[model samples]
Target: MLAHQQQHAVSQADLSVLSLLTQDQAPSPAQVASSSSARGQPHASTHRSKTKKGDGRADVDPLLIAAAAASGPDVTRNHYFHSFFPHPLAYSACDDERAALNASPPGPSTSPPAQRPKMESRQAPRSIRLQVEEEEKRRLERLERLRREQMQKEEEQKGVLQDKPQAVALPTRDGGFDFQEDGKVQAQASQRDADRIKAPKPGQVRHLQDDSLVVLLRQPSTPPPLEHPLAEPPFPTVGAQSAVKPESPLSAPEPTAAASPEARTPLPPLEVQCRVRTRIPTPHGHIFLHLYTNNHDTKEHLAFVADHAQMASTSLTTNAVEGTPILAETGERRLLPFIRSHSLDCKWHDGETDQERIVRGAYVGRLTETTHIASHPNPHSLDPTATPPHVHRSHRTTHNTSSQAPTDPPLVRIHSECFTGETIGSQRCDCGEQLDEAFRLITLAGRGVIVYLRQEGRGIGLLEKMRAYNLQDLGHDTVTANLMLGHGADMRTYGIAGAILRDLGVAHNGVRLLTNNPDKIKQIEGEGVKVVERVAMVPRSWVLAEEEAAAAARRAARKAKGKVSGGDKRKSLDASIASLQSLDASSRRPSDSRSTSLASSAGPSGYSSRAPSDIDGELSDGDSDSSDWDAKTDSSRAYHLRRAGVGMIGASVTSSPELDKYLRTKIDRMGHLLNHPTQQGTLKRVMSSGGASTPGATHQHPLSESVTSLDGSSGEAASR
Candidate 1:
């Protein structure tokens, strides 16, 4: 109870001291002592005042004084009466107390003024300020430099205008005027103005008056003036000369017979020059890759020539000065003709040396660092008197051998570049597989050529081709997609390919063309190349299917034989084999009919019937004859399973809906001469419909009946 009373008394004293501090009048020393005594503390004010006078130190605690000073204006009355005092506790002292403390400055009661702590200045660093100044300076400099250049150009133009004399119009006899400067005719505006004023009437000739015209004639022997304008003038200005120059007489000496203004100038004949040739060793075999430049297009078309015998017969020891022999003196006669590029072997210039010719791959045999023999301009020329002793002997031998050699034409395939199918292995098309197959076939044939044309996506280009792919994803066929993108079904041309063939001496004799597109055959033949025979390039998938069917048939025959007695076993096996053969024959009849119908519809001159021998001969081993279907089938099956398995495994093992659709489009719309397996169902549908055009039928060609009939089964097969 006593402690509580004492706390109440201290609170009361604190309240009294706060009230006294808030008042305008200063509290007396006696009052401060009474307040201290009521709070149960010593009379600190009076004691501190006496101590300050005696020992120069206040009796008050320094910590307590500092606490009162550090306490913000909210806690203290310093905000009400702003004044500084020597005493730290008297921070909020009134004006009278401040004046009294200031007056007694020399006494021990006075203390030095309290110092507030220093604060950091809020300003940018010196480096940042300098950087900003430098950037501003550079910007100003750049603007000034631009301004100076512009002013200089304007001054130069002004000087040019000032120096050149302005043309004045001089009246002519026909009331027309000529623009003259410095007494010379700067521009003849009279004739142009007169012509524009009155156009010539139909069937009316306006005779030009000699007196009205001013002619500047030179002697017949003298050369024509270099500044003479031979053609019609452009819009006549005061001093401008004619902008249109006449077509040079030397450029086109013979005038075209066509007088129509819309007649176009005939383009020069397509000429291809083999720029470079190098031996590239591929996975199949070594091929001489020839890069060609043509007058028709800027693209670098290529030709992969597979002539192993030609390379083997031509030796490095052959004379470089004369013609290189088509056969080696010591070697056997070559069966294949020497497929050499005439443009590449021809002397490029009089200064061209044998080393330079050899460097450009115009050499006879395998080019080595130690032995390099350049080829002659007419390497195939059979003039024994002009050749060296060994070359003459070899040439005679080649001539004799070639005379008795079989007249089998070289295989030629015109393949377009396919970035998606060939480079990325796209399943949508069998382009990469076809290219590889072509290379293999040509290499196996011992003498062939594959012209790799740079016509990506049927000549629409890669960008458009990718766009076409998107359209295909949107449920459009390849032909329809190409049409939607404003491109033809097949925009490729074989003129350059034909020219390249001519340069290589392959098209001159004949070529067994490998292609499924009848249009390609037509276009190639149009280019003056003879296609002796048409070799069908059957898809590897179809080959695999045939092999599988053959295998299944054999397995069934074996199973039937295994379950019977000796005499009955033979009969059962024979029956099974006969049934399988009958089924195979039935299945192939429709395809055969379709091919025959297509050939007849194409007319006699269009596409010839593909001989079974050509197909078998193309894929068969050298030992097998055309009639040996079993051997040929086994050979092709083994090749696809072994050599092409890595690249075409997916195509062989599983069905490709994209590939099926692509093939269907080619057969139905693009007029490609290919037989699809699904053609059986389509033929049945067409026959059932009485050859009427069914709804959703896309085929639109003369051979559409035959083509559409062959389409329905491929989709069903792909689904299966």
Candidate 2:
């Protein structure tokens, strides 16, 4: 009975499961719970509800719940609503499955329909294509016609088919008959037949269409006779010409002149014209600045003429109320020829008026608003026999001025442009100072000329000159720097300068050239401008040094004399007065060996031999005590005042290491005729106990000693 009962229970469980499976709708939770309750078992729904109640959580994943909780209260259940939808990856999976299902062999229903044929069988006939084809056809036809005409012209020019008419057959794309004259057709046929028969064989000579007689594989044959036997050969043959003119066999053939290397055609002569001239009143004196244009170069070179004749006359006339002489008896005005530009004085055109001439600076005497006198044109002004219109009677004075006094030649300085030194006041070169000194000297001399050439950096332009400055900063000398930049050491040329000098009528007589460069002298002399004397241009620093040394010596002499007199106050004052007189006299005299000896004596015991530090201390002491010198005698005070005034004038350039290096390079390498301070034993003790002073030790050099003394003395004079 127990076995039967277990079997019946098993059969009933099987029947329930079968009935549930056979039902159309799945059983709900209520039905499942009822069935379980009836069977005396725990309902699945009840167990699930107990589990959910005990866990106290929704059906959400624990990770998602934790994420939501950590996201803060801003994230609610709505934030996770997107998770309920299908994941993008799941959609991709569905797409992949669909693609796989579709990837199987296509059935009739899924196959793509066949594309219908295009309405136009081929590509649509484009008008542009038709136009292009027509144009190409016309171009080909034109080319063929041109070719036929060219062939016909060539044959006629060659005289090969002079009587035959050329019949050109036009090319046809379609098979078509071409109309032609029967005679032309027959002629072409005959010509073709002749060519076929007359073609040259392997061993025969073939004559080219062009008149060349080239021999082939066999021995050369005589050329066929010309159609016109009397015609002259196109080119003359040397043998035939020589045969025509027979020479004596005994006499050597006339030697033909062979070209010599030195036989070069000379360059055209350089011509220059003075375009304008104007009187410029400078600090020194009045100068006539003449601008010149030359054929050799486009640069407008300048000439600064300090004409004593004109300047003296003007000055005398201006101060005539004071009864000054119209012409001074200095003999400079008579000896020096009047410097005038020939080209400027010449009439520019036939219709030119005196106002035009005066406006262009072609006038005689001083040009003033009240007095405007245009000079007469004198084309032969430069000729020896011709006299310039501007030359006055004072210039023609035959007082034998040359014999009365030895006339110093008119000073001339050929100055090349130095933008760095002149315009910017650079001390690397003494160019600006030299220019200023030149003006001062020329003004004092009463007659001179300054030809200013526009050759900056010795013909290298300003840009290259700046580049050379950088090169010089790299421990190279000026010459080496120029050479490194593919330039000559000095590429300056004086041709324009010479031309300008000639135009001014100053080069006829020799000039006393103010320059330290021997090369400039040689070059100017080569231009047919005579340089009778070369005036050395000593630096102003050196001049100031010499003056200071002399002054120092006079002071020392006074002091020593005071000591010899046993501190007698009156005797010392007397000695000081005498020394002051001597100083005045010496200062008035021109510099000579006496001044040089004084400088040498002062060099050993004065600033030149002293170290820079010692000089500085002495300068300080002098500055402190300068106030006491005011109580000295009037003569002594006057002497100091004069020296102080001179000091201010020569204080433009202060001594520095760069200036020293530049001077050294110019002296040692550039062949400039300047004396170094150390060599002269003047100022600046550049050489120490050793043979040469070190470049790095600038403080040891006494270059600033002279400068300091001058400054202190000037300051004392100012305080007084």
Candidate 3:
């Protein structure tokens, strides 16, 4: 520290002396060098060597030589070295006095390397040492302050523990709330009180006597109100912890007086009431119509009215001149009250004009069911001026302003002729019976049109069907026989049906199907018509059993072919056609001579309904056709068995007592046939004898036993 101070002082002194030396003007180098050479000092040569760059190897002190030549000794000597050395020190210090200068090194050159040891030699003064000691003492005081602050914090925590018994129950001593254990809180409180007594000195206790204990008492803890009182606390509903203070509104008590009856005793459901209305038309003459209103939407509430005997409400008004209540002489007014009550906006006078659109000269009038309000025909209503059929098709595209397409015409099954089962009682199939059923349903609906196609035997012609029958007799199945007759298994198509539907304007909304055949459904559907509903057309009693058996067998065969047909799939279309043919024959006979002759022949006498003579005896021509009796018998038998099987199964066991009896009889007969002892014996013998049967032993078949087992009587079995 001294050396540093001395160096600083010397630097200030040097600046002062240097300022004095530089006060006069200095001499030039040439003169200074000349004088220095004259001096002959060995250091003069060193000077020359050092400062000879501008003077060419000359040890010349130009300033000194100039001063000497100018006759100034002091000026010459002083100028020489003064010009050569650094300012201030150069002038004040003796040029040959190196020892003192070396002793006290120049300010700039006095480094720590030289002064460090000297500094270490002196002991520091007591005042500085005392200052350091005081500083250390202040630091120690600060540390004590922090310690005291920390201790006070701990004391405050201890006081909190004393106030709140649960404070010390926590696992952590860091003073967080603890809910993990019991009893620890009370124990902690007692310990805190004891610690308090231990913590204060006698003097502190005296001061404490002056302090109020109430001011130190802990504040009571209260929870904030819940945001949603109806909601449970943060715990599972099933847990025991879920039950908290009665703050939840859901947990509030309820009054029993205001509770509903459902809360006490539940009652049976009340019957619902619905309103339904049906517009029925009768054909007793003059368009007679009546609306039937009921609480149920069922056909039983809507009775069938004969065609041309009734007229439903139309969008147009009925002519008042026609008569009040649109009465018909032959019609009854039983449903008038219901109609008047349910009708909406009905009109008494019809203002319809004949200028409207027409199909084949027949006016296409819209019949409004509820209100008899009709809209004037649009400018392009069917366009009768053009081709009626095409115009109708076009009109369908725009009939309803809001509808996607025109309403579809009712589905019509234009079934073709089948002579054997249909006309003649050739009931190998159900052609006759199914035809009858179709006619009945269509006539009942009163909105369907059946186009009778002439395509018989699936377009192979009736003769071929007979031929196919011969093949079938030769062991060919129905499909195989048809295929063998130089035709597809089914050659019929729906081209004519399509044309008929088109003519009838049914290409839009869709048609209600009356068939179980998926093929027929697909065929019509594929022809741009929707199949809304399917009405099953089953056959009559005689061929009814045959129809069912054939259907089931066909279904079985189809199923065995690895395809499923509930006898409803299109795969059974051929079977359906057969059924349809049976229906048509039984229902619609061409009012021609052929049907008349057959009807006359079956009208009693002339051996019309004769009983079966024998097992193979010919049936009287009256009841059934005798032309193909052999083939008919097989087909009829198949049909009868199938129909009966399906019918028996379909009949409700508990509901239909008569049907139940019939089914029971059938089941018994089937069981007898299946479990007949002779048949079983024959089968066993055949198996044992390498699949060969007795040649001419009359087969030794127990005919009476078989017959008795089948139907409990030989005569019954033979007759069947």
Candidate 4:
């Protein structure tokens, strides 16, 4: 009867707890195990020790009562396990059976039973699968016993749910492993909160536990809030952060993204300013080039202003009150942009006028002829002699200065300076030809601009260019030499050129540019200035000489071949020598009396090519017909023919095979735009020339500034 009554009470308790569990947890294996284990939460040994005690209806739950006094060992007073099973009758049973358990111990112990820990503050969840399984097995035994009790006493179960026992004394919470109500409340509250939150956010790799995914991967947090109570952040400190002010790898500030020169760097802007505008009179025209200095490097650069004679007084007049020059600084012109590039000290006022800030000069025309003048400095003294520009300030020696500037876009050329080519007769390059051609074309057209940058040797300067020349002679090209010298292939920048154009006020309409380089076109045509037309400057002399040389070589080759096939070895040499001699006579022998008379006039002049009429090299061979040129061998004759052709008309006596090689390098290596029509030209030209059908990179036309840059060779030249 006692066993039946005990079974009945246990049946009522089991049903109540199952009903409290959520419906989702009913099927979850882990949750089922945890909840099922709640019955024997204190110990797994209670149910195991009770084995062989009948699994029938006679059995009573050990956890339902406080102890087993008659049939088995007494239940331990574990405060933590009692908290989980909070049924009121369970406490009364403990009070009712405590006296009985004391009289008879649960086991034969030599010493008192060990006291289990009651509460724990979890920083992280512990693996409790074994604890769960142990409790689950014990619960199943109790559940089986309850099921049989329900089967036998189904009618008795109705009143057990209504009955309750009075509340008993509960244990106080000690913050440590002593008993606690708060920890149990906190754990339940936290578990409920976790149930509401089902899954992690997208792409996050965190687990649903107290432990972190990767503690080492934690990065630096943002600065502490200004109003934070503690000076240090409230976050849990790791490593040496607590004792010492520490800097961690995780707490270091992230570096900004700046990985490229073009993106990350801010380059100093380009600049060109008009320092002074001076008038220089020449036989072709009066060139009034504007002088300027740059901020990027120390170099005195200039540009020729077109048709600016009327504006001369702006440069020369001495205004007593103005104090500053009108050309660069005058009347509080502080906002000028070029002033900053050159790093000039100036300031701009808020109410500055556009007109006051604007810098203006004069324009020249391409059609006008510049007045030619001569001023000998006593041929020995420093002071300039009596001249129109130097003698009297007011008197002007102008050439058609009355003519208006051209309505069309002004012609423009961006010429890099070359001292050797311009000062002396340096035919190693065509810098002289280019300078003359630019001046001639612009002056002939009457209105144009030429920004003469003092960029000697493509901006490497005079000394480096000479070194580059030595390197070139040692067999490296101009492009590679610059690289070997730690410079780019072409270091010239058109930024200043563009800026000067905008300052000149002539850029708004457009510009007629003179150049063969396609790169020049892209850079110069910007802002208000558009390249409306393109004009080419050609060296007719070089092209003609190259053609003459090719023709003479072919004739010598043909004559030698025909005579050698006749089987007379002596005749072969004779024919080859005869052929070369014939060419020498025909070219050197004056066809007219004027040729003989004009021999002196045909003498070598300065590097500057004479005007458009005398574009050909004026050959000045005095009465010497030497036999050394036409040697008695085919190879010898061919060599003579090549030399004769190059030096025939307009070539200087100094023009040798080295001169030809130097020039070929200019066209090929330095990328000079001029072309030489010779087999001895650039290897690029020779390979491209497939014999008697290919055209040259540039060709000469009587009046045309147009030349097709074809790489193929044309048929050998012929003389009239």
Model 1 lDDT-worst window of ten: 600-609
* Candidate 1 wrong stretches, greater than 4 Å: 1-266, 315-335, 369-371, 383-406, 563-641, 644-655, 679-720
Which regions of candidate 3 fall more than 4 Å away from where they truly are? Answer: 1-401, 404-411, 542-720
Pairs in steric clash, model 2? none
Q: Write the per-residue lDDT of candidate 2 for residues 1-720, one digit (tens) a residue.
A: 743343233334334534543444445555444444433345443334334443444432333433333333233333323544322222222454456546657665574433322223475469878998999999999999999986675455435333223322211122211111221333454453345334534543222321211111121212223222222222110010110122222233332211111332232356666777889886556888888765445577899988655544322121222222122323122233456777787766543444345556776556663344565577333223223332211122222223222223567889878877776677677776677667655654456889988877776668877887888888877766666665556667676777677666555455666765656666676676656555555566665566556556756875776544435544644554454334322221222321021111111112212222123222322333233444444533433433233322223443556667877776666555444766554443212212222222222322111111212122123224
Between prediction 1 and prediction 3, which has the larger lDDT? 1
Tens digit of per-residue lDDT, candidate 1, span 392-501: 10111211333333334677899989987777668899887778767766665456899999888887678979998999999988876766665556666677787787
Best by TM-score: 1
TM-score between model 1 and native? 0.46
RMSD of each: 29.1, 34.6, 42.3, 35.5
User: Would you list the clashing residue pairs of candidate 1?
Assistant: 678-713, 678-714, 679-710
lDDT of each: 0.51, 0.48, 0.33, 0.38
What TM-score does candidate 2 reach? 0.45
Better of 1 and 2 by lDDT: 1
